[model samples]
Target: MDRITALRARRAGIIEQMEAIVASVGENEDLTAEQQSQFDALRAEDDRVAAQLSQAEDLERRRAAAARPAAPLPGVTAPVAGQPAVPAQPAEKGLTFARMCRTIAAAGGIPHVAAQIAEANGDGGLFANQNMGSGPAGGFLVPEDVSTEVIELLRPASVVTAMGPRMVPMPNGNLTTNRRATGANFSYTGEQTDIDATGYTYGQVKLSAKKLAGIVPISNDLLRASSTAVDRMVRDDVLADAAQIQDRFFLRGSGTDFAPKGLRWQALGTPFATTHIMTMTATPDLQKVTNDLGRMELALGNANLPYTGAHWTMSPRTAMYLTNLRDGNGNLAFPEMQDGQLRRKPVHVTTEIPDNLGGGTESEIMLVLPQHVLVGEHMGIEIAMSTEAAYKDSSGTMQAAFSRDETLLRMIMQHDIGLRHLAAVSVLTGVTWGAA
Candidate 1:
């Protein structure tokens, strides 16, 4: 075996042996001297193996990096005599606010330039006065690199983005795409027979942009702290909240008011209809789950939907219960559950799927082909700051005027979600774990 594989195998063996040694000693009993010595020796060996594995992995990574060709620098030319040589691009590094600003500026966007101008002018733009660093008001814009780092730190882990849906950049107010329900057919003819008209149905799905915004209040003191520190804190908080709201609406939104129509709601409409909804038997157990999954597969097969890249989505509680279930032979009912999958399909666990539905305690489990899900997002986020503002109180029942010492930051993002094909999603409703 290769060095890395051999090291990993050795580590696994050591871990197994350690587990055996621990099990040999009764729960309430102490290990004998010999046993203790053996344990210590095994631990030391394990540590050595782990260190070697880490080194091997690092070496492999370096080798891979060295093997790849360097990317050509754009807009960079050979240096002339008397002029300093243009520096080669540096290695990939973590995100920073300064870098973010430069990138934004490079894109010819207004936000990055505005931030820089605000910082330089000391006009109290996007950042607080103190965070602007030792600078006259006229040169206050945070460094592009610093802004890049801050933006990187604020990025939120996105489930919708992870699913790899078809992303359409909606620059206009609305986007419309024609979807074909059927295709034209051709057949071989012996003679010059009259051609028959092929029947095909087409429909359009219109996705209109919906706005999601969050307002954050920060004390002047906190805002005046290190711009990096304050930017990190505020950006993370706002983006995280926005990501959660987006994910929730993308999965279960009813498309009311400002919310986008999500997968669950779209599956209930025409083209998909209720045929994709599968109801479990009286007792919802592991066997029933497996059976329902089989039924779903069959339904999709009959509908001629490809099963590749399909995934299962359910609540964490349901997943935990299913993973812990044992068969009649005391073997794991679903051995692959440890990998967060079912029947070789990836499983996504999210609380967005409500547990209280049909029976007030029923949860939904769905099989979805992410490629059929269409998601649209506006490219950039807009951020504005206000020192004098009226904000909603904690209860949201009353408006409170901001104190002179406080500042309010408002962030706005726009996006929408829709399905290209309803049959590509099938849901199992009224599912419950354990005994009926």
Candidate 2:
């Protein structure tokens, strides 16, 4: 029926043959070297086939057990807040990548010790290439642990702010003086009479005016630096989260191990890192995922940290993956569309992987109760900022007045979307810069 079944059948035949060989060896005292070699080869083949069959059978059993319907524990109601609920379907095999590098000039070395007993060894454990994860002294590989690290927030860097414009009074208006050549060499009769020193005073007093200038608001470099730093710090925190998750899998373990890739260190210390760029194709509803992320984003906005700017538009595909979610009705609820579309309700959510590098890292954090799963639980999530906008209030109009014409102009300050590990920590990147 299967390779395993076939192998078992072949092994049974081999055993019979091996028995005959044993009988012959006893009766004849000695057999030809060629026959003895053949017997030994056959015995070895039989053992190999038997092992394969046993392994196949074990796999089948585990699969069957996993397929069995899960029964809820007696009296276990709602899952505690902040924890992802266990998936009713076998935990979807998932992978996360993490990368950790030193932002400082030097990083300490990671300590080594005997590998953990649970670590994958020379033979492939839960994943392939177990050797790749091994470190010197058979210890697990990990980011160099450091006692002191920089917290970009505390640094002088911050968002730029305009305390309106400073006023330098200018001479109100332009002045022009006309000095008529009253007494020219060829003047009119009356003028000629005035030409004589006794007739009119030849000397003239001329008046000219010089105007004082105005002072304009200067660009705040320090504020820009601070905003940049805030963005970098948030992103670094996210990267750190991914790094922590990766560290947990330093030793051999199931699922894919994520490593940071395409890390771009831009000016102002902004670090753009993405999870291992692997794509998974599934029926994961994108719309539901979008709504969930939007709610969180709105919460961040309401909390006052809207750093990301217009550049933070999320992809429609990513939105579809995020917005449609299970609702209070315990039914698939699309944020935009209240009613369920397809018969398949949103059972679980795989947060949209954030794109467009920003200050914060996407996390598998957040607990959401799904309608389909018997145990309402939180699921790991990916997040990205869709868009960020900002406004300042100077002239009650939320606009700044420039000195150029002493006119009030509305200025929309742009910022980048920033993700925070928690709502309390989200400081919208670059939204409000220079201190007023």
lDDT by residue (186-216, candidate 1, tens digit) is 7776678888778767877788888866666
Q: What RMSD, rounded to one decimal, does every model reach?
A: 26.2, 32.3
Native-referenced Cα lDDT, model 1: 0.66
**Ten contiguous residues with the weakest lDDT in model 2:** 97-106
Q: Candidate 2's residue-wise lDDT over 335-416, tens digit each?
A: 5433312222221112222333233422221211111001010112112110111224325344232322121111111111
- Tell me, by lDDT, which candidate is best: 1
Error of 2 at 322 (Å): 43
Model 1 CA deviation exceeding 4 Å by range: 1-156, 186-195, 216-224, 227-231, 386-408, 434-436
Candidate 1, RMSD to the unseen true structure: 26.2
TM-score of 1: 0.61
RMSD of 2: 32.3
Each model's total of backbone clashes? 30, 54
